[model samples]
Target: MKKNKDIEVRIEETKKTISGSTYDVTELYIGKKKIGEVLAYGPKEFQSFMDNEELGASKSLDLAIESIIRQWNLHE
Candidate 1:
């Protein structure tokens, strides 16, 4: 995929407590400078699979970008 100059993507491991068990999840960040509600790689897609699975940083970024592009197309 081509690089996007307007948006920045970052992913990191996050720990959350669920049923008293610590779970690690891959968190995807896009356009940190523009903060607000986002749909890319959001809970709707991420939580569809099993929880606590390791999603590579690049994979997360790619997925987020793809989602954003698809959403952008819908508005066009």
Candidate 2:
């Protein structure tokens, strides 16, 4: 776990395939602990995630970060 101040967003290659295609995965980490990942790399892929996940936040990035922090109990 981390203070969230050390939160990092990183991109890496993966052999995993999604929807019959493969993309460089983006991962979120708090210090050394990985919290989440996104299989989408482009705008279309991101939109796919939003649609499939049914995320309705107007500010998706902010909401995603906040959600992760909240789940990690790092909002304190």
Candidate 3:
């Protein structure tokens, strides 16, 4: 089994043209496969992730990564 660090997630914050506002994701990854992730974000920005579509999709990747890691452990 791989430790949490073995997993990875990537995220890109959405930018607002009007107010120059932006938000970051707490976690992000490819479809059903996590390579790495950022676990922390600014207060208001972190909340935005909960309502962001990108974040939702990334969550699936995270799940897949976890599953893969668990399966690897069983083999070990």
Winner by lDDT: 2
Q: Write the per-residue lDDT of candidate 1 for residues 5-53, one digit (tens) a residue.
A: 5645465566666677755554444545211112224434433121233
Off by over 4 Å in 2: 1-16, 22-25, 39-59, 74-76
Ranking by lDDT: 2, 1, 3
lDDT of each: 0.41, 0.46, 0.36
**CA error at residue 2 for candidate 2, angstroms:** 16
Q: How far is candidate 1 from the true structure (C-alpha RMSD, Å)?
A: 9.4
Give one digit per residue, the lDDT tens place, for model 3 in 1-76.
8566443335543333324644332334444643333222333222212212223222343453354334434543
Leading candidate by TM-score: 2
* Residue 16 displacement in candidate 3 (angstroms): 32
What range of 10 consecutive residues in model 3 has the weakest lDDT sum?
44-53
User: How well does model 2 score by local distance difference test?
Assistant: 0.46
Please identify model 1 stretches exceeding 4 Å from their true place. 1-6, 33-76
